[model samples]
Target: MARKSGKMRSFNVAVVGLSGTEKDKGQAGVGKSCLCNRFMAALADDYSIDHISVLSQTDFSGRVVNNDHFLYWGEVTKTSEDGIEFLFQVIEQTEFIDDATFQPFKGSKMEPYAKRCSATKITSAEKLMYICKNQLGIEREYEQKLLPDGKISIDGFLCVFDVSSVPSRTIEKQVEAVLTILNNLIKTKKPIVLVTTKNDDANETYVKEAEKLVGRKEYKGAIMLVETSAHENINVDVAFIVLAQLIDRSRGRARVLPFIEAARVR
Candidate 1:
């Protein structure tokens, strides 16, 4: 009898976080968009993956038109040493709340939050657009079904928080939102990566506290923490790669380990 080959593993990763506002400058979000852009830019050069499709919600003016969400797609057809093939799709999301009513967007209303727009291919020189929101929306009834009860559509989540914004009430609220997601997924045992962004400007005390928070007994050592700096091109790729490995491990597939080691060497 001939040996049988397994199917390729595909994973959908949601980048969730709250947007920060600078009352003085009127800016939104902490650094979720930047981090996504950085990872996509380095995917080809650093990880040796091929770009499938890249899309965004922002218009020419660099503003998120129709208050929509953004989505970016990519894939790893071959590992560093031509190992098993893997496909990865990453989406950018924020807490969907109506600006005027200050209420969560639900049902048909959620459709516009991540409405697909013209696809854009990002280059190393081009900067990815950013949308500021208190938090990224992860659940949608009608959307691509990123996550739903049982049978787990979404494979993993990258919960990003700005280390520089720690101690602030807004960031604290963001952490609470993340905890809620973790609690919901506890039963599913889904892999999650707690990414601390803006590490280049992170406060040592805040970073230490963040580490301790993830180490709490409630988490049971399930979450992987990675400190990243999207601005300086820091551990952005490492965070995603780790999440991929975790997703593989959760499914009893350890084939991604070789690529991980290859990524570290380069």
Candidate 2:
């Protein structure tokens, strides 16, 4: 699960959460920003879990596969000497034009995982190459929007909610965001994970309600429902990792592997 060497890559992770002042009902203090830390290579300010970058994936048939690394996306809301509040984005991978418009992004964690699940009929290296090519295409799609002339191409989204918020209010907003992303940014259905933070405030009722809501909507891609706590490091890694795995599967690849990094000398 080491970072691919040679160059530093980044990605755009849609970290959509409530941000507000004390005047607002569902304020921003929720661990929304903190979850961004865990998703980006285990970057907890008070605590840490490095495994967020790599997910132990599997195929539908069921098989343990290689660890896939994913990028966390967001803008820097808070900054400190130790690190920063938002997920890191590589410049070249972004559509940053000038100081006024600094674009941030997260890298695709697919090529590695795809390299591991290649069908028996296809060579691993070949599969990896295919994944790389697709990723490049996705990046290109966003490249236009990266320019000022185009709009942002948000392929996926992560709706973060706090357990302390009004259950109905938070869940409602989350569902709305998912449907909007489905109809707008993405060309096809994409994976969406429901992330409820603050494990200490675990509400069984809220969890059940959230599940029912998702069941009713029925997203085309895989769905992961989990409660995580950046405060206690509870299932933090699993949440993000599962999202990455599901996204890789969305590409219609029943299996995976690589030709770029896993190419054989033969």
Candidate with top lDDT is 1
Per residue, candidate 1 scores C-alpha lDDT tens digits across 1-266 of 11226555566676765532332112345566677767665443332222111223222112222233443333333232224444555656544333444443332234322221111221111222232221123212212322112111457777776677544345456556555545554545668787887777776666775677679799988887887877666667667767777877532233222222433644
Among all candidates shown, the one with the greatest TM-score: 1
* Span of ten consecutive residues with least summed lDDT in model 1: 116-125
lDDT of 1: 0.50
Once superposed on the true structure, which residue ranges of model 2 sit more than 4 Å away at CA? 1-11, 20-28, 41-155, 165-188, 217-221, 250-266
Report the lDDT tens digits of candidate 2 across residue range 96-184.
01122221112233322112111111111101111111233244333121211211233344555566555335655644544443333
Candidate 2 achieves a global lDDT of 0.36
